[model samples]
Target chain A: MKSTLKKAGYSRVQKQMHDVFLQFTSKVVFFIIIMFAFNLFFAGHYTPGGGFVGGLLAASALILLLIAYDRKTLFKMIPIDYRLIITTGLFLSLAVPTLSFLFGTPFLTHQHTYLQLPVLGEIPLHSALLFDLGVFLTVAGTTLLMIALIEGEES
Target chain B: MTTDILVLLPIIIPMFAGLIMLFIGRRPMAHRVGAALTGLLMLIITLWVIIRVYNSGTMVTFIGDWAAPFGISVVIDMAAALLLLSTTIVTFAIVVYSFQSIGMEREKFYYYPLILFMLTGINGAFSTGDIFNMFVFFEVFLIASYVLITLGGTKIQLQEGFKYIVVNIVASNFFVLGIAYLYSVTGTLNFADIYLKLDNYDGNIIIMTIVAVVFLFVFATKAGVVPFYFWLPGSYYAPPMPVIALFGALLTKVGVYAIARTYSLFFIGNSAFTHQMLLFLAILTIIVGAIGALAYTDMKKVIIYNILIAVGIILTGFSIMDQTATVGAMYYLIHDIIIKAALFLLVGFIIYRTGKVDSERLGGLIGQHPLAGWAFFIAALSLAGVPPLSGFYGKLFIVQSAFENNHYIAAIILLLSSLVVLYSLIKIFINVFWGEDMDFSKLKPVKYDKLLVSSIGLVIVSVAFGLGADLLYPLFEMAAEAFHDPASYASYLTEVE
Candidate 1:
């Protein structure tokens, strides 16, 4: 397939152009900033920045790296399995409500507190925020994994 | 004694499950574990909601200590709860069916989470007190569905899925706009609040009708009503069977549920105008759907078209707006969810076994797989509204309701459409299962594990509703009452806190 693409006059410069255009600018900083904006705007929703936006940001970052470097380099840098990211997100989201069940609160009844983290100072950890973060990670990881599979088809 | 968690459980469980599925979806074992656990949890939650509503009355929950107009709320009256229960059952069956059909290669980590999110949307639509929340939930489910529909990322899947995504996104934007206009006019998003406000605003009836019509078009697209239904067949035909079955069973019904909920609660006075429009659309939908079904040779495509038929009948029943008709529509909606899912799964099984879905190329499966053939037969019979099955009761109720309302022409069309549906289904049965034995020497006998499980589950469910009509009749009646009486729902929320 690589040889066929090469034979078809696919140049490294074109690839580099794509890496610069589609991957670097769109995926890394812009994607993250867009996600932050989405969350900040929709925070009135009681849940900050939804999972969908978060997922897009994370996935774009990975896709950018994949385009800038080779797949092998991309793979090595992200040594953690994509599945683990998704699973951990799922677990954290489920854990909050499941723990609420133990306390006799209805499922997803939000609980919150402020915790002091030496250098980070007091940070509020609302269960809803945790839920949102879970959504973000899962969306990001799963979407990246899907894009990876699609990109892999080229090889 | 305590506030009812039953109403809230369906929404919360699936949201939690989606979150968990996101994390655990990468491993097949973990995915299965997560799927099974969530399925069981949903089933239990549904059954518990049923029992609670049966014992104490409707379930209502408020969010963030806010009253109905001030904050988000969830309400599960009998109708909503019944739909929620059916959705849970269908989703559980589909999830179980997916275990075998969606092999590890395609059961990507995101699949389970997407399904859960899809369920969250369905449940949220069923239980949400606010219209805006319903729109939000609809978007949630819609986005998840777009992802699920295109899970495999085939060129065709992507092509068709893009159309599906674009159409739904447009509809959702329209839905948001409709809700904004509704909120501006009524000063509230809660269903009960809207209903109450609507009663006082007799002067702006024209504007109200226009908004209602806008909502009708938005939901019509979602429900696959005629003219707006073109996207359904092509897009649905692109997905894998399990996913298609899930979509066939649940997605359009959510749209129908929204239409039913909104019209009943807020637009009761405008039924005469709305019902006439619905009647026209419903008739067109039935004819179009039946014709589309006949046009398709592939079993999955035929089933997709038949789903549109079911949507039409349910809408037709709703259009009549009589109590009995509403009851019939509710019954049909539930029955269709079970039978259609079963039919889709069966077709999936056949495709798996034969590696061909075109009816013209397939034959003689009855002798080879008696279990599957028989299950398909029963499901088809139920779908055709044959006597002694659940399907008959729904049609019977709708027809009787039509006659009661003196809608002779509408009643005739309903019966005629059923006959067309029957013929289409029979064509499939004869072509795929009974005619000539196709060569199977080269093909290994495919295991119909998920098909068998879900088929049996659906068959038993349909039978229970059929044989125990008396027992289920009151449930349908209760659903009708819940829909008709907005006060009961409104009072419950206000009374709760």
Candidate 2:
């Protein structure tokens, strides 16, 4: 059957199936771990955990996927370039505060505004969140990129 | 709006450019676009910073709406702004210069983002009001630099880069430990807040002294002072000329700026201990750096050693603790960045032409490459403190200020070091440019690339600074004013809040 699969162009599909199964299972387990880490990060912000830890957790999720699957498969799964993630993260981090300069305020001046949604309720969008999201993306992207480079070199 | 933007713009503009570059940097067209946009944006922002700093006392920005004591802020006084302006200028020059010197393969990958990130770290370090934030930014910059330094993955680069990374990591760990102790003592990361809190606390002088000494060691490693400077010559000479030029120009200066800021604001109260230590370090650094310069035969090594000399001079300014001495330090810092960058770029050009940086194999290119030779001569003279040039003014100011402050020993060491620097630079000039004409039959005539020419243009601007000192002196004076007046920075942030 393996020989048949290899000869019939099913090898690619077979390998991909094996890869996908491994990735999906690991991702599930990894997602749970990350969710746990995220909760801990949120609770520990005033104590220890913050953007850096949260970002590291997200990166670890990607690392888990990389471990379970091939680079090409993993690259396909994560469509956005790690560089873009890093850059966008940095931009978001820098931009939120820069907006304050426009309003004659100092940089990174966190202004909170509650947006009235049509049905859900009021959503509080604080600039600090944007900065945190930026930090998250940068850390995750940078970590993933480093992992990718090391993996690429090793292969 | 003008003043606030002026303060924020230098940092914001480069950051934005950096972000934009990250997306489009893979495309050939994007490289040009990124370079042009970054250069233009930097130039405009620097000009705005200069104008605003001259007109309005100092600019301050608070991050996240938190007041000065509670949250992070970025303050851009004349000194910070001037450093920002120079950083932008050197980055712009190097980026333009990279167009030709860096291969297309490299430009597509690391060149633009690394530079932009480097600038971000530099600008962040310069503008940040929080000491911890300064450390964070320093890490940001250093991490990028580690990548940039090791970008090509050559054996020599890998070896030297490893040492550089290890040394910097150790320094960083020390920096973090210092911050921890500082926070434990003062319970604040804000520079001004720490200053205000520490002013009243009569803590154990011994603990404070140890922390201060540790802080000095961390910065000294970064700034390439004396015993901590071995990594600089080897690592700096490992990378391509353009990378080395940028590193030579800005990295140590950022370290020096941190020292200057910390010493002036937080540590000023303990001047008797801190200043004396700095005075001793400065003199030792000068003597050691000059001797190193005399010993090294490689052009890059000599330049790196000269950077140590510049560090010594700048430290001497910091050590004296007088207003005039600080001003001299400020001027010297600015002059050193411009001249040293120019010198490194000139060396890059020579290497590009000669296919070698060693003086042993290279000879008699003065006539063949007159432009490169003369540029090297001017930059070397400026570095050695030749009269009527930028270097001379900086050395003269420091010497005068040191003498006025009764630091005659430091003054004399500075002067004697300048003479030693002169000898080493002249040694390069004689051997590389002026000695007997070597075999040219096999040698390819060095074609001056446009990027190389643009770098020379930057050197020309530094030379112009020398020629037009009268015009630039007022700006330096304003910068001196800004550094001395911590109240202005603190009050500005508080008022905004």
Each prediction's Cα lDDT score?
Answer: 0.80, 0.80
DockQ of each: 0.24, 0.41
Q: Please state the error at residue B245 of candidate 1 in Å.
A: 0.8
Q: Give the alpha carbon lDDT tens digit for every residue of B264-303 in model 1.
A: 7787667778878888898889889888888888788888
Model 1 DockQ class:
acceptable
Q: In model 1, which residue pairs have backbone atoms overlapping below 3 Å?
A: A39-A49, A55-A139, A55-A140, A86-B22, A86-B23, A87-B23, A87-B24, A90-B19, A90-B20
Clashes of each: 9, 5
**Model 1 chain B weakest 10-residue run by lDDT:** B1-10
Displacement of the residue B136 alpha carbon in candidate 2, Å: 1.5
Best-fitting candidate, scored by DockQ: 2
Off by over 4 Å in 2: A1-54, A72-80, A100-105, A111-130, B1-3, B445-447, B482-497
> What pairs collide in candidate 2?
A97-A108, A108-B64, A109-B64, A109-B65, A110-B64
Once model 2 is optimally superposed onto the true structure by TM-score, how far is the C-alpha of residue B71 displaced, in angstroms?
A: 1.6
Using TM-score, give the best candidate's number: 2
Off by over 4 Å in 1: A1-155, B1-3, B442-444, B494-497
